[model samples]
Target: MCYAKKLNFKLKTCTTLSRVNALSSVAVKFAAYLCTIDSPDIANDYLKVQSLQEIAALIGTTSRHLNRVLQKWTEQQIISRTDDMIHIKDWQAIQEISEDIRFV
Candidate 1:
């Protein structure tokens, strides 16, 4: 897969820990840097992915509300799409427009 995997600033934690599961691998990498707009609302430690219904139950909000929140974010271009999946362009872009970022 052509992943736009940001050079995670949290690499130290990743290397220090032995077991980085699929969910953790994605969540921690995102949380440490890329989770600004495209992040899930839940504090996904070890990434326990609950169904939409389960998530709605925990947060006391319907899935429709959550979808609306996500849709607004998409419209802002604060986050973006890639091959039907979300990808953070870079860690640095979290604080600014993605287009304003430059590699130095």
Candidate 2:
């Protein structure tokens, strides 16, 4: 049997798991960084200037994958994305997801 055919999990579930784990691993560092800034809204400015490629490099991820994850988060209302900006819409939710490894 092929590798994917043997799994008990759906591919979508697996992808979400991967994204959450990746984001959680980085979230501690990111959340701390956010706190240092005077306002949460300012984070959008930082996100705005960086291309997805640049942001991915900074986060040690592929641009394509990061973009997909961001889009998913946007759809979920965890974040809002504009042409050049990304705004974190829910800090409490973000914190919960970031800190809870068991989240799903």
Candidate 3:
């Protein structure tokens, strides 16, 4: 019985860590996408027609999750949202976060 409890606890801990890692990866990818928006090598034409939901899907996250991440960024003044658009207020910060793997 004690062994079973330990195994269960280990499973839960692994699951939690996996979730954290997945979210971190998603954030990094999203930040990378934002950072490269103006890069000459990056094609952004798809963004012109994609809605937030479509973009979120392309990024491998749900729209609600993407919105939550954006909301947090707005609170931190890293970006601003008006209507259906998002403007990066701190390109350096976004790039740093993307490179440093910082979630906020």
Top TM-score prediction, candidate number: 3
Across 1-104, the per-residue lDDT of candidate 1 in tens digits comes to: 12332233234224423332333322232233233223465333422233544333223346676456445556765456655355544445444432321111
* Selected candidate, larger TM-score, 2 vs 3: 3
- What's the TM-score of each model vs. the native? 0.33, 0.48, 0.64
Candidate 3 lDDT: 0.65
- Overall lDDT per candidate, in order of appearance: 0.38, 0.52, 0.65
Per-residue C-alpha lDDT of model 3 across residues 41-68, encoded as one tens digit per residue: 6554433224788657545689888888
Candidate 2: 10-residue stretch with minimal lDDT: 41-50
Superposed model 2: Cα runs more than 4 Å off:
1-49, 100-104
> 9, model 1: CA deviation in Å?
30
Off by more than 4 A, model 1: 1-47, 81-85, 88-104
Please give the lDDT score at residue 13 for candidate 3: 39
**RMSD each, Å:** 13.1, 13.2, 12.4
Candidate 2, residue 39: Cα displacement in angstroms equals 8.8
lDDT of 1 at 68: 62
Clashes of 3: 0
Compared with the true structure, model 1 gives a TM-score of 0.33
